[model samples]
Target: MARPIWSGILSFGLVSVPVSLYAATEDHTVHFRQIQRGTSDRVRNLRVNERTGKEVAFGDIVKGFETAEGEYVVVEPEELDQISPGRSKTIEISGFVDLDQVEPIFFDKTYYLGPKGKEYAKVYTLLQKALEQSNRAGIALFSMRGKEYLTAVRADRGILTAHTMHFADEVRDPHREIGNLPESGTTVSDRELTMAEQLIDMLAVDWNPDDYKDTFEEKVHELIAAKQAGQEFEAPSAAPRPSNVIDLMDVLSRSLESAGRPAGADADAGGGSEAGAEDEGAGKPRKRASAGRKKAPAEDLSELTKAELYRRASELDIPHRSTMTRDELQAALEQAAVPARHLRAAS
Candidate 1:
């Protein structure tokens, strides 16, 4: 069994249940150490005194809170702990609210709550069942590790889960930060809206998180393995971002057709019968189906401008493209445009 990070009483109304909090998630990201380029010597960080220009011991460190008057109030760890919200070992539930009422942006970390002892299991189960039936979460204030937090306690699969949430004032208004948002009163044509819905229906699939994997992480591991084997390899080229669509209706029509669905189909009708299983690579714009017109022949590299050539190079996933000259880009594109079968036979 995993050890609990905190032990506290969950109090609401007249009932109090003793519970223990355990972290619900763990980090699995790959970590690297800083080192000199040519030498095996690892880089190390040190805490040094600015005036003395000497390294400081961990025990000698003190906390300082900067004041508005440009002065720091130097404080010891013990002094701060004395005034901390440490004495309150209770998660006091202030209100109950629908789970949907809470925005996901406000949530931070998640932890699992379990009954401290077998005796408290009944009350714990009672709260869990009540919250599950009501589709509501308990908003509470909890103090842990010398700090107080706003938290939401919700039931998940018969277990109590607590999520730390940002205070109302801590969340910034998006409207204040962003500019030129679409007007709320702006209207969409019924025809365009119906076609967009049909396109969406053609692309919709059941949510299965297991179907996705971090490809970048997988590539990093591959690179590490190749380096360990003393094999020379070039880094994969980055995919270019698609340009903004100038023709929304044309794009939507192509999307529906590519998904094997008829454009402007009734929203009430089921999706395309010929539609393949949705994958990560699905729904991308294909060159062959642009506006239901036949694909034009590849442009003459000698006739195209530098910017046009750069755009084509980007589309072809050329490496070191930002540094490539116009002629070099054209040559690279021509080399890449060679038939795959011919290249394979030559190899």
Candidate 2:
């Protein structure tokens, strides 16, 4: 049996059940040690001072938070521990929430929660059954490795499982982080959409994890075995090419055909439309399904990330982009694009 990593009382309303937390998952990836090139000498890392060329003791190091370039606020481990939430011994359930209400992205590492002793088994089983039948997860908190984690506990296979979760601030805003995402109003032809749906329907299957295997990991093991035996490892076949604007429809049609669904009238409808060829690559004017829809005057600067705006500022030879905030970057980017828009209008 696996050893428990933590033992605590799981608080449920006025009732408390003694439980043990064990890791629910294990990594199977291969690990390797560092070695110097052209020799069998094992390489090791040590804490050495760059300025003094002397080794620094672990106790001498302090946490640094950078507020600006080459600037940091020094912090101590005890200071952080003083502010950390939850106690080390107890995994306390604060409340219960509908499981579906919690987004999948928020959930992180999983741990199994078992009754600490057979005497507490009744309470554990009762809580497990309640959670399962009600389809709710218990929101909990516990400290581990000097940090408190927000967690969700749900019943799984007659046992309770807790998953560490990201706070709301940790989940990034896509509009702020990502670039070049399609606008909500972007349109596609009905024929293309219908064919895509049909293809999905043809390929849909019940998810059975046993049906899949990590082929790359398998090949890695094969390579190591072959090299150990002094034999050449055979390479796998080349992967399929990526689809582009010109070949997208053809690729989709062929994919349907390969799945035993022939491309009939509905699939071929609007096959020659100019909308399919628009925006073949960047800097080209994109077209819409409706030919009458005019292009927007300029790119939505708000949609671009700060780094993208900084890159644009660099390209346009704009000043002081390094010190600018996201809003300032957007404003500068908007100002820089004005001349080009005017020149295009004049032409």
Candidate 3:
């Protein structure tokens, strides 16, 4: 079971429920330690003073704020508390709003909120059901780890799920970056749009998180097991894509036909399929090939040329391509190909 990180009362109006919070998500991406290339020595970060160019002892460090030219106000722990004595005990709900009205962009970290004891279960269930019936989320403020956070509490499967939120200023305006681009209207035709919609309909399904799996992680573990068993490594090949996608509409039409869905029906109308359910949360966006390998114009691998293979590999940003032999290149290319193959196959 996941451990609760904090325990406190969720207070609002005249009601208070003792509750505990546990992290709702975790990072699964592979991580590696920094090391020196030649000696493979693990790198260690050091604390050094910028002004004196000398290493500083943690005990000697003091927090300070610069207030004027060449001047700083050193602050002690007790003194710092006098400046801003933020509330650390309460998760105080101030208001409620429709859950849909809160955009996904505002969501930050998520936490699972559970009743601290049987005594609090009644109120917890009451709050959860109330929020569910109203289809609303509670806006609350809480302090943790010395920082204050605004959070939303909503009913999910009979429990109150709390999500920390980003301030309006934190979400960057997508328009600012894409503002100068030419209008997409000129590039998209009505036929292409219709086909695209059809393709989307073909792939549509209700959100069922249980279906997702981390195939890449699974493949990595499998490869590790094979390596441990001293199995011979087979050279990897790039899956071929059609060199010329005659027309985007054609592919969309084929995809829709393959899915057995009519173009006009709602994308998610069909009941449900369990085939790809395991891949729900673990699936990520598509990736490009390495810089050294040639890219296939289409997503399939058979349509690639030797030159395109080089380009695709390069686009994927694979390393050590310049001096690598064909066999080595193929092995490197496999790393990029496997995840994509799994996504397409699983989907």
Candidate 4:
């Protein structure tokens, strides 16, 4: 169990629930230490006086506010503490609003709010259930660690969660920073729009967070393991950047073709046995007009490269195709082709 970062009473109207705030997430990114080249010594950072070139003691450090005249007003930590939010023990809920009403950009860090003691559990659970049923979040002011934050408290699963938010002034206008955005009056033809929608529908799948992996982190760990074993690490080749799309209709049409068969059909319509035998024979690869199971009607699978096979598998919505070997992809594609061909026949 982790220690709570904050403990306070969550108050709304006449109700008050004693709660403890625990960090809802953690950073798992790999970190590296700065070291001198050709030496094992770690680099050190020191706070020093610019004029005297002498390292300053930690006790000498003080908060300084620079004036317009280039003079700093030295302030003691105790003096700053006096003006701090004063660690208010209450998170006062101002009001409740629909969760969707809050823009995603305003949200910052999240913290889980648990009942501080068993005596408070019933009230805590009641608040959580109310928020969940209402599909709304409570907007509140929370003072912690010398600062006050505008926060949103909502029910996540069976518990209450709080997310710190940025004030309106902190968010900038996107138009000022971004250029070359599509014109407001720009429009697409109905046919093109329909085709794009079809492509999206064909490629759609259920959301599963577990399906995603941190490939960069995995590679970093692999590199570290190789270095520890006294082996040289060769970087993987970078993928080619896609060329800009000049023809919207062409792109949409190709995308639809690549999206293979629709869900739910016979999985053995195509000549599966023949495809497997041909794959075993290891014949010369061929390039198809479009990288999809059913799109390239006259294309031969035995002639396609591993990259082409993977692309076809992707269009067919094969799970975990990214980590599959060339042989594995080919086999998967063969199995996928059955339903794809069946759908084509029905169509």
Predicted structure with the largest TM-score when compared to the true one? 4
Candidates sorted on lDDT, descending? 2, 4, 1, 3
**lDDT of each structure?**
0.72, 0.74, 0.67, 0.73
Clashes of each: 0, 0, 40, 3
Q: Candidate 1, residue 91: CA error in Å? A: 0.9
> If scored against the real structure, what TM-score would every candidate get?
0.70, 0.69, 0.63, 0.71
The sequence of per-residue lDDT tens digits that candidate 4 reaches over residues 230-302 is 9998898999667456776555555544544222211222312212222212342222224453432334588
Per residue, candidate 3 scores C-alpha lDDT tens digits across 212-283 of: 988777777777778989996554577768735457655665565454433222122232121221222234
Q: Which candidate is the best by lDDT?
A: 2
Clashing pairs in 1: none
Give, for candidate 1, the lowest lDDT window spanning 10 residues: 271-280
Better of 2 and 4 by TM-score: 4
Q: Which lDDT value does model 3 have at 61?
A: 86
Task: Give lDDT tens digits, candidate 2, residues 163-215.
Answer: 99998989998898889888999887766775686567545545778989888
RMSD of each: 15.3, 20.6, 17.3, 10.7
212-272 per-residue lDDT for model 1 (tens digits): 8877788788888889999976788988657455676566666655655433332222322
Q: Model 1: residues >4 Å from true position, as ranges?
A: 68-70, 78-88, 185-188, 232-237, 262-347
